[model samples]
Target: MSLVVTTNVAGMNSQRALSIADRQLTTSLERLSSGSRINRAADDASNLAISEGLRAQIGGFRVALRNTQDGISVLQTAEGALTETQGILHRMRDLSVQAANAGSLDDDARGNLQSEIGQLRNELDRIAGTTSFNGRKLLDGGYRTVFHVGADAGHTIAVDLGRGTSAAALGVDGIDVTGPGRYGPGAVTLSTAAAPGTAAVLTIAAAGGSAGFSGGTGGVSAYTDLDGTISVGGRSFDLASVRYDTAADTDGNGTRDAADLLAQLNRAAIVALGLTSPPFSSPTPGTLAFAVAEPLPGHTGTAGAPLSASAADLARSTPTFTAAGGASRALTAIDAAIERISTVRGDLGAVQNRLEHNIAKLGVALDNTAASDSRIRDTDMATEMTAFTRTQILSQAGTAMLAQAHAAPQGVLKLLV
Candidate 1:
């Protein structure tokens, strides 16, 4: 090869090789120091994008796990409150059973029991009203929420508490185990004789103004002029100048007696006014029982707003255990309330379990996603070190070669001398 001093191409080529090797060495060092292969988009653009996506997924999974935990906490709070409510309901049941022993317990004893029941009922209402999580009421019948349990959109769980645990909601608001009988004197007793169904006894007391019906008045003697109208299911029936004995002999037995009075009350016209067929019955001597046909209006106990009985009215009626058999009925109501509370607690427990599973799932997803990101974006220390060693050796060798190329022009000068 002919040698030239003006431009030593060999030196230029050696310098270019050295520059490439030095760049490789620098890159290897950066990878080793940072512990990342794709520090910049230029390192591997597509893989960098993929790694970023995986990182985002991992972040979402972490947040979802936290959300599931929070959801579980909320459910636990609600369930804990319900457990207390169940205890109260059980106690109320015991009180009702105790009050039911009318032969042994006197008015004073029964009255004390009723007082306890009232307090317990109030407590139930308070629990329903006050039970909350994160400032959201859980037992007021309006609790409905969603928990995000997954990294992807629409991966959620819904929680809804169907109804409130209040006394009114549980049909124990009007529990009164105190009275002369289960229906109470002068009270309108509503029941279904043919089948077991909803029943209510509305006590219209003389102390509330008009002279109410006498529990001792048997047959037609029980009939009296009700000064006001009795409303049932929003329909009103005028009782003015109407006497049970004077009404038509509806029993078809000819004589107008208690049965006739019941027949008149169950007349098609009255039935059309929301009174069920054969609605009235005398469960005992001188006692008037009116089977509720539909929901009754609020029992104001005033002379003008006498309401006919229905299951809905019973739910709103406060129970007085002071009357005979009143305690037995209250016991039944307490049992029902207990069952309701149990159902609510069960639902809450189920939700808690589901949330636990959700947390596990989120953890697994986060782990897998993080691993995937590591594969795409993280450098292997062993592999990177090996590459660094090779690049370092190449850099040194290229530098030496560049020096040789630069000295080659001196050989031409020696020939000239």
Candidate 2:
């Protein structure tokens, strides 16, 4: 090698090595301090991309876990309400059985049983109406939703609680369990002389029949004109719009008979005039009895005033246990209602089990995904420390060698001297 003053080649080589060593040392220190192998895109581009994708999946799994938990809670709430409803049904069933024994029970004893049943039915309805989860009704026959149960879109579980558990929904709303029971008091008889725009005379009577109205002397005439508007409660209906059953001309009187008129009045549209229950019950083929004892559902009006009932409420008014034959019919109805409730409860249980399984699956997925991300992006302390030591040693050695190379230029001066 030539000795020169202008440039010491040995020193330049040592400086270059030192620079490279310092850079490696810095990278090693950063990895050790941060505990990450890939702190930026420059560290490992492809691995960084893979790590980010795994992170997204992890986040999605966390949120989906929460959603699954919420779904389970909603189902639990609905199931709890159904449990209460089942208890109420069981009690009502016991009453029906007791009332069925007409030979052993008198009218008063059966009446007591019927009273309790009516109260139970009311409570059942209240539960169905009020049960909710997060302000969403769970038992009103409209609960349906999806829970995200996986880390990806379109991975979901659907939950649906069937129709409802109300007394009406269960087909036990009007169970009487008493033979020949009068429709509870506060019903008005419509007069044959009732004309449109004239307030129908409201008479309180204890009519007797298989279903509350007896063939009695006081009743409406079949030929009474019903082709105009009549007001009930605070609403009006065009009576001419009433759809009389074309097939119900029982009297063959060349015109619609009282039975046809009664059928029209009981039509869902007319009954929806705001009463809590159907307003009209027939005592005979020609007589229409109106019930004004209670305000319409959600209505707070005084008794005896005209009101309306929804079609749903009307369907709930089927008489039960009012006579020997009625009691037999009620047993069948109660059995069917019980079966329906059992089916709903079974569905809820199945959904709960599915949710629990989904949670387990999510946990496993989260663990495996996290491990994969760690492998791609996290530092291995043992391996990184070894690299750090090697770079540190090279840095020190390079510095000493650079000093020796700088001294080589002085030797060239000595030769010149």
Candidate 3:
């Protein structure tokens, strides 16, 4: 309040006030344009940090929703395939029941019924093995699926539907080829029978045989009545084409019998019989014996249950209606298979329902989280505009005052004059 010629302190005070008002006005304009309360760390550092965290969570939730949808799709694929398997199993069961009526279903009719039943069983195996989702095998029991449902560890949904229900897994017993094999009935005795890997000659013959070979002719052609192709363990081999010699008899002196024929059956024949060579047994003169073993190449695993077949293909097998009650056992197996398939379908349906609910929950969570984040980070347009208008008035008033203060020095000039 002093009239001094040396300094105009009033003008300097007005200039400082004007600068403060101008800076505030610019800040209000920026807030209005960006529609954000915290444009930078300086605006509201705490709230900006908090909003960032919330945004990350919202993103995670969206990803989890997508994962859930994908899981549902995969389950749907498996469910459809299992449904078809159920229908096939039901048809097989019906056929088995009909075939069981021994008097009504004669040998020929039963044979036809069994043929259809076998086809159905094979179809079941095919569906179980080949059903897939997004190139991942679903029904093969080899896939173990996991989906992350939350942003943190241990927040996942796991689905483990192990190897699907194949016909073999359903306990559908395969056909018994040639009943029980043994070293008898024209048993050809080995000169020196080695355990498993030993190769020796069939030198002697005991009577009671299907085919007799006379050493007089050097080689009596081949074994009779054993020329047809026999199927074993889902493989077929022609026994007629395979040549059997009593240790390469040079002068027709080697005594060849039915055992020699069985031992020297073709590789294909051996595989078809489902028995590995060198069956452990001392060969009688005319016969040799081997226990009937279903070539389960990889069914019974090295540790208890293996999955690989020697050929990596499940035996394409069917039951033959040869026994008196063959159909009865088949009917039981079909019933069990049906029950198992039903269980699988039920599980899929339940999971689908659960996932639908999970999606709904995710949607709710996303909406709420966005709302929370908006409250923390978004500007109130009405509030910002009001502040901007006020700052505009203050800046205009400050400019006028600053000019008046600067002119206040003119009062000193008037005193000088």
Candidate 4:
């Protein structure tokens, strides 16, 4: 090599090598400090983006799992309430059986039994109205609760817990007028109640209809869909867009003796059909008693003398349990109520099971996703430490070589001397 003082080519090469070593050492330190290889986007931009997405998914799964847990808890609350209602119903059934033994019991004894039974019915109504979860009603047929089961849109589960405790919903609110044989003597009563000069005699049955939301499925579809024409004042009201429940309607134009006619009346039941309030009678499960207008253009009766109710309209409304055979009717109503509670509990159990599975699946997914994200972004401590050692040795050697190269220029001074 030529003796050069001003231009030190060897020094320049040594400095370049040192810079490379220093850069490697710095990268190793950064990984050690952060415990991650991709500390910055520059470290691995593509992989950083991928890991970030995985992190987002993991977070969502965690929240979704919690939501599923909450849904299970809510279902449990509802199931517990139904269990208690079932006990109350069982007791009521026992009382009704005791009351039905009219041959062995006196009127006063039966009346006492009936009063207790009435209180039980009130309790049922109370449960239906008060059972709730986080302020949402459970058994009033109103809770259509939902849970998030997955980390994406449209990934959810629903709890369709309908009115399991309501007297009307359970078919327990009235008498067992589902069958003609179920009626006893005096189950129906008819008397003259007419506007001045009107001599129409009206009759009302004490037993309710056989058809209602009775089956485990609630025949809810029947209650929902009702498309029919109810003639009032010689005009009609369209029942179009009623719901899916009334599709299997077995009412209307049937023989007067047939239960179908009564059931149809029950489905298209009218509560306030009077021109004015001659009297307002609350419905009994198997019976109805109220005066309605004659529906004549100008002959509608006043409040004190409302027209006799249309027989057709009277038949359409739900029936109540009659005073004559109320005990036997109560037994039948209790049975139906018990069935409804069981059905609701079973449905809630099914939903809870599904939610448990959802939570477990979410946990597994989160674990696996974390593993994948770790592989994409986590630093290999052993491998990074090895690189740091190599760079440290290189840096020291480069410094020594730079000093030697700078000293090489002193040889040029020897030549000059």
Displacement of residue 98 (Cα, Å) in model 4 is: 2.0
RMSD of 1: 11.9
Better of 2 and 4 by TM-score: 2
lDDT of each residue in 1-417, candidate 4, tens digit only: 567678999999999999999999999999987989998899999999999999999899988988988888888888888898899889888888887777787767876876776787788889989988888888888777567789989998876887557766776665322222222322222223334344333222212323322221322123222323333221233333333333343544322222443344434433211111222232322222332322223223333232244333443343232123556666766888788788778888888888888888999999999999999999999999999999999999999999998998887666677
lDDT of each: 0.70, 0.68, 0.61, 0.63
TM-score of each: 0.70, 0.68, 0.62, 0.67
Candidate 1's C-alpha lDDT?
0.70
> Lowest lDDT 10-mer window, candidate 2?
206-215
Which regions of candidate 1 are displaced past 4 Å? 182-324
Could you give the C-alpha RMSD of every candidate to the true structure, in order shown?
11.9, 11.0, 14.0, 12.1
Which regions in candidate 3 have their CA more than 4 angstroms from the true location?
4-6, 106-108, 172-324
Greater lDDT among 2 and 3 belongs to 2
Error of 3 at 29 (Å): 2.4
Give me candidate 1's TM-score against the actual structure.
0.70
Candidate 1, residues 1-417, lDDT tens digits: the string is 877899999999999999999999999999999999999999999998888888889888988988999998898888889889999999898888787787898899889999999999999999999998888899999998899988889999999887788898997887777754533223432333313453333332232243344321333244454433344333345543355546665657655554555456556325333322344444443344444334235433443333445544544443332222466657777888888888878888888999998888778878888998998889999999999999999999999999999898998878898
Worst 10 residues of 4 by lDDT: 271-280
lDDT tens per residue, model 3, 1-417: 678867778778888988998999998988888888888999998988899999999999899899889989888888888888888878877777776666665567867876787687788778878888878888777878787776556768878775566777665536221222222222222122224333322222222232233222444544333223333434345434555543233335355543345445533444444443433222232332222233323233222111222111212322221222346546655677778778878878887888888899899999999999999988899888888899899989999998898777787777777
What ranges in model 2 sit over 4 Å off? 181-327
